[model samples]
Target: MPSGGESMLESDNGTLGWLNFFHKGIGYFAYTMHRISGIVILLYLYLHFFVLSNLLRGGVAFNDLITSFTYGPYDIFIVMDILLSLVIFYHGANGVRLMLNEAGYGLKHHKLMFFILESGAMILMLLFLYYAWQVLLSGGGV
Candidate 1:
């Protein structure tokens, strides 16, 4: 009989490991990205609420927070904002694709659908970044 450690190792070997999960195929990649994007958006929601709660301290506090975002050193926040927007766009678009697949539309062409979804997401992100860059150069906040 195999030892306990040997049995455990066997099971682990048969399972999809972390590196394998990423390298399997486009479906796995899309699934992983969807999960990661969901988690990021959830975390961003908490941060958004925390920032909004500053209003409880009155207009000055809120304005200070807003002002910090508009200045020189805080320009990084604009970049983060754009990244968050891209994540949101990707998650939302992929979600719609998933819904369509669930409804039995394009089930046979899952790989192709994933490619289209990813391409669309990239295009949208690029357009968004372009607009955001224009705004930033014109001295605007995200």
Candidate 2:
């Protein structure tokens, strides 16, 4: 038989080529980005909930924070908000599909669910782009 390196080269030349492996690597990159974005969104949700819970202390502090958020560093906030919206939407929609698949629904409707999830993500992304443009035009006032 051929040596180990030669066997690997044979497989690489056969079906499991380097190009296919590169594409698969890209898929893993997308998956990792999705996971990381989801975690960031979850962290934001926790912070949001914590702030809302502060409504217990009457309106002044919360309202002040809200006002500060509205007018604060417009450029930074606008970019961050747009990015966060995309991340949260993608993460949430993709996460539901993942959960459904994990519960075995995927076995029943794998392609259908994947299409649904992908379409939903695309729609959300477009909506976010539109809204982001609107916000930018509005100078991030609202």
Model 2 CA deviation exceeding 4 Å by range: 1-23, 73-75, 99-116, 125-142
User: Whole-model lDDT, candidate 1?
Assistant: 0.69
- The candidate that wins on TM-score is 1
Q: List the residue pairs that clash in candidate 2.
A: none
**Runs off by more than 4 Å, candidate 1:** 1-20, 140-142
Question: In candidate 2, how many Å is residue 123 off?
Answer: 2.0
Estimate every model's Cα lDDT from 0 to 1: 0.69, 0.59
Tens digits of lDDT, candidate 1, 1-142: 1111112123242444422444456665566567678999999999999999999999997877776775655757877887898889888877877777767776677677767877898898889889867875686544
Query: Compared with the true structure, what per-residue lDDT tens digits does model 2 show for residues 25-122?
Result: 42333344555786798898898898799788779987666555656643466567767877877767656665665565654554466567767987
Model 1: ten consecutive residues of lowest lDDT: 1-10
RMSD of each: 8.0, 10.0
lDDT value for model 2: 0.59
